[model samples]
Target: MTPHISRKTRVTGAALAAAGLLAAGITVGTAGASTTQTSAKSAMPIKLSASHRAELLRDASTTKAQTAKELGLGSQEQLVVKDVIKDADGTTHTRYERTFGGLPVLGGDLVVHTAKGGAIKSTTKASKHSIKVASTTAKIAPTAAAKSAQGTATKTLSAKGADAQTPKKVVWAASGKPVLAYDTIVKGVQKDGTPSRMHVITDANTGKKLFQYDEIHTGKGESQYSGSVELGTKKDGGKFTLTDDGRGGHKTTNLENSENGEGKPFSDDDDAWGTGKPDDPQTAAVDAAYGAGVTWDYYKTVHGREGIKGDGKGASSRVHYGDSYVNAFWDDSCFCMTYGDGEGNKKPLTALDVAAHEMSHGVTAATANLEYSGESGGLNEATSDIFGTSAEFFAKSEKDPGDYLIGEKIDINGDGSPLRYMDKPSKDGQSQDNWDSNTGGLDPHYSSGVANHFFYLLSEGSGPKEIGGVKYDSPTADGSKVEGIGRDKAEKIWFKALTEYMTSTTDYKGAREATVKAATDLYKAGSPEVKGVEAAWAGVAVK
Candidate 1:
């Protein structure tokens, strides 16, 4: 139940309508004057220059040896740098992954903040307890663990003919206490066309199944979701190829209705693509290419991220995958996006928001790497939904206007109803509108409702409203009124939190703390934006 929004609706000066002003807890008269104040306070944080970023990475690498000792980690624990971010005021945030006794430690990622003089400012950890295990030896044999893992995938995931890979030793510390475990990856085809990479963690000493999560993410979608959109194609001797040279050379290929392997690359004699109708195969290709390009532009233009991996390397998109497959997915292993022809192969799941949603999974993988299970999985899905909606709004497509509703144009439900609604997630029936004890037990798509509701309130506030001709009525958990800080600010806060503070094990509570810290970093402490973030989270029962 992922969703996808535009920047043109920004509140400026007296342009802040009565509804928006009221939503912000401001009077119309003061709105115009407050605009300037807000702009100064909410100015974008300075991005790290290439040279400076390189320098920080070098420093981080040199300091890695002492990190375990300095942080009071066990003698067998070691730190590996993952990412580094430098703020405008010379503050640095270094993200790292941990290994215990030479074994990869699940949920052992953390971020360390430092001042200008290199002194530690604060630390955010996925696990608080020290990394210590009884022994590195595993009592459970790899074959036995793999067998159990494969069985779980077949029974729980309905994965037919699931094949288990060799189990690897690791330290599992995601919940409760740290323990040595064996993680086995089971591969198979899901009920849908999605490839299953279910990771099952088994206790090494007891040989008991500890946890399992599928690495593959799925979403429901149509061809030419955008009407007559322009595409970036490459010219090769009287022919054009669907390669976007401008944005990391992103290319679109045709799967030829097959579910296996990468298909042929899409090329056209003329630059024109799509008939705005599904009857044309190029039509679906047009939507997929356009959606990828627009999503790329949105990330680069809005967040200064060069590409999906922020490395200027483009990922490919494959369309027309499997006949009547009815789903779309992002596979990190392939580093590409796959779309299906829905229902009767008449509705290709190549919509703009769907592309954004799928690709945002790559962004998440490159950063927080949020585990796709329990509460963390919900946040992971919500992250994609939030950014998917943001990219849609950024695109501002005339044919498919940005809205809080997901899969509105794709018609995923067979009916005219949308797949999910951010205003009231429960509108989808399965999604939860607020956090509860059992939220973690629900599917990631359903549990994502809490964060979705919070984002809607943070961007548009509670109550009834209309934007882009779509009506919405967002309610809070406690029936409290929340003032919005605008989508522009909300997106910035979310992006910062995702890249800088969030980790693989972050849940709703951690998300709240990360976002508040992000708001405070972007704006001063106690700023209106910070208050708005806190209020929005409270509205969703996340506080």
Candidate 2:
């Protein structure tokens, strides 16, 4: 009964300014590139147009049954469309999740790629084996499975009051052969003040624990506001509430030192909010709202993503969570972002990059649904860091300019050092700069250094360079020099791979293949961009 217990990992980011300003219209250069050239290139839309998107959705929605049958899946299996992506060449990629006999099939997600004529070109599946179980009946009772899960959570996570939810029968196909299992969720609070939602999978016949993973993803950051920023507020009678109708009606609330339930909505007599000081309660709300808005804009403008779930619906932001709680997290159950005040409630973890980092977690959940364990977990964390840094750069904040350093302004370590360095991940002493056999054995936060290093080298190339007044000297695993194809291209490639190709079980090697395929799709085969991606992955010893 040795269940894999996934722990909560930390993420960090820098401050942001000009919350209302949209980066979509602005053209910014990367590293030493010319601003004019960069702006023109950035202005060109890389995502599907409105009509094309509608068409792709329609096609995907209508073809799920036929596609599933064509794929030779079991008769009891059914496909549910999750996302659709259309390329400029009229190629379409549709992502789907699988279910067997009405039971959710874990790790059964797949992507179907179709040519311009609607012919299936290829498919990427999380699990290669067929999904069929001997019987749906569970030899072990659901109550017993729940109790075992709760006990496992209590023993491994030090969870307090760990109550188990009703167990659900699911097809456990993430690893090994497909089997009927009981999926139990244990809810409680961890010893570190982090909310716990541990998912435990137990084999039905053997009553043996298969795996367990925590739902809470924790991270740290600092908030620094230089001047006033515009916030999206809605007028209700006389007072204005912290709701942004412009961007999916996203709202910000105050937890007021409480660790449970949704907090009260922030309201003001006048639209004017925040004093740019942490002493005022409204100040933290302002920072949080601003960060959420910027993150929303970053995805909407840069990635053509409507919202966190890409349904044009907004996720709420909760600030001032717990007393002196120095971390922030994203909960998919609530579909909201939660922030905490640093030690003594002095520093709020509502920086722009942190907001982006946490929200990106939601995006990953809605797309790749990456399992938060092993190498897949490392890729999950790195995806957030990559997008967090990209959003930070997109904001073009002069106060805390974009750099390769993560959480540089937060000072979470009580020292002036940043939480992690993307250029050379090993600088943190705990992170790996290159991939190895044991990379997956490290904590996801530390193992994430491999992909972070790959992204940095891909964006800025290997060797020493200066960007936004910050000096970075990135090195390759093979000590070979690699040239960059710029951050804009790198971001697009990663985004495409995540939404269209990668799956729950994808690891470093799969990530390398996904990125290369994404690059080849965006840029023609054998293009410089494709070569750059291959070289970058090799730089991280992924090859």
Candidate 3:
């Protein structure tokens, strides 16, 4: 889950973010069986039957205004329906974006679940803090804002010995304050041709540097899933472009050894791809394109998510970027996932889980908008790992059977070892298996281990375990035994918590609460899922 590059580059480590904060289900399919923990005993939750789901939706309020009021967002926020998903059971989950005072609130997105009869059962908010500001007017001139941005960008760039680019103005209400700000975007390629994009946020009111974060998310992906994939290609003048029509028209372009331009799309008259070798550039494209397809399928099939943004849109993926570039990244500014040839173009970073990891970042941006720093930053990274693993299992590909290891095949370390491990995160000698006050001080990649451990414990229990042929020996910080609720149920719980219960500033503690609440809602107050969640967090020393 490491994107090679750092998460947010606060104003020289000044913590770039909104100076604000606030505060499922076990139903799934399975392949092979693993050791299971005892069932949890909790109050009754929905059994997730088709009849039950249908009943929930059959009684749902069709009137948008009525539903908004039911969710408690009808007061000052306008609910703009982003997506409405009705499961097989007829239970409808509605996703929404919020606007306050005629301006969009960045972290104010949420989802509401309604039982049968349109009665709102529960609501999950991205941020509990109200979106209120004293003023939206800018006291500082645009020139001053630009200078502030330029200075901050210059300082940040100089520290890295890079150059700067132009800045633009936008209304930022992410901090619950509608303030005018300059979104200074700096573009420059490193000597190695790795693309650099710095998003520095400058306050328009006082010309103060509010916050800054890097747009490039460095992580590490091929026909890596299935030996062959059914791709959606378009024939242009007898040339087939690597465009996926089924998935919001996602296109995988070849960099042709360049760093930035959208290279020519892989084309073949016969629609045959590469030879799966470095000498043939099309090989990497096949992996990129195929990986993208599987990832799209994973989200859509299991989670019912439309796309990375749930907007029924596809994001472009660039393959074969730069020379010997060993990293892959997702940039929200461009809404694309980019991959690089590793070491010598022999190891294309386009692996199954890798693709899922990168694209999950986009999903995060769209949903919870988790700030990519501190504990929240760690959670953001963990979310990627969680989904990446989930996607791997969801695909259930023979080539890359689901496993607890990340980047196992990429060889990003130039060694045989995988990037990270979920069973015992500390095996890498960096990640933390338990939570502590100082956990936030660790790098997002390492700090994420706490959540990773929690998830592992919840899904697979503690002590000795094996899944899909991989061996694991998990332990708890408190030396307590933890029973798992199964990965399927565990993942649903995590996703529910992420989309509905968590806020932008949620930390480890918040995560524990959110997940428990999600379990309570999805399964029942005292259900096995809820108890498993509690024991898992305790296993990770989070409680």
- How displaced is residue 457 in candidate 3, in Å? 0.9
Q: What C-alpha lDDT does candidate 2 achieve relative to the native structure?
A: 0.82
RMSD of each: 6.7, 7.7, 10.2
Give the Cα-based TM-score of candidate 1 against the true structure. 0.90
On lDDT, the candidate that comes out on top is 2
Q: Write the per-residue lDDT of candidate 1 for residues 444-519, one digit (tens) a residue.
A: 9999999989999999889988876778888999999987778887888899899888998999999999999888
lDDT of 3: 0.69
Report the error of model 2 at residue 2, Å: 60
**Model 3 C-alpha lDDT per residue in residues 1-543, reported as the tens digit of each score:** 322211111011110100001001133323212212212112122233334434434434356567767665636557666544453333456666766655565556677766656567777666666655565565777666656665665565554434455556555655545566667666655444456676667776777777765666678732232244456666666566777767778888988778767677777766666665556777677667766777888777766666786656789989888888878888888898888887766667777677888899888777666777778888999999998888877765555567778767655566778788988899888999899899987888999999999988888888986666678899999989987777878887887677656766678988999899878766656666688899999888877
TM-score of each: 0.90, 0.91, 0.79
Worst 10 residues of 1 by lDDT: 11-20
| Superposed model 3: Cα runs more than 4 Å off | 1-104, 112-122, 151-183, 189-193, 202-208, 221-230, 234-237
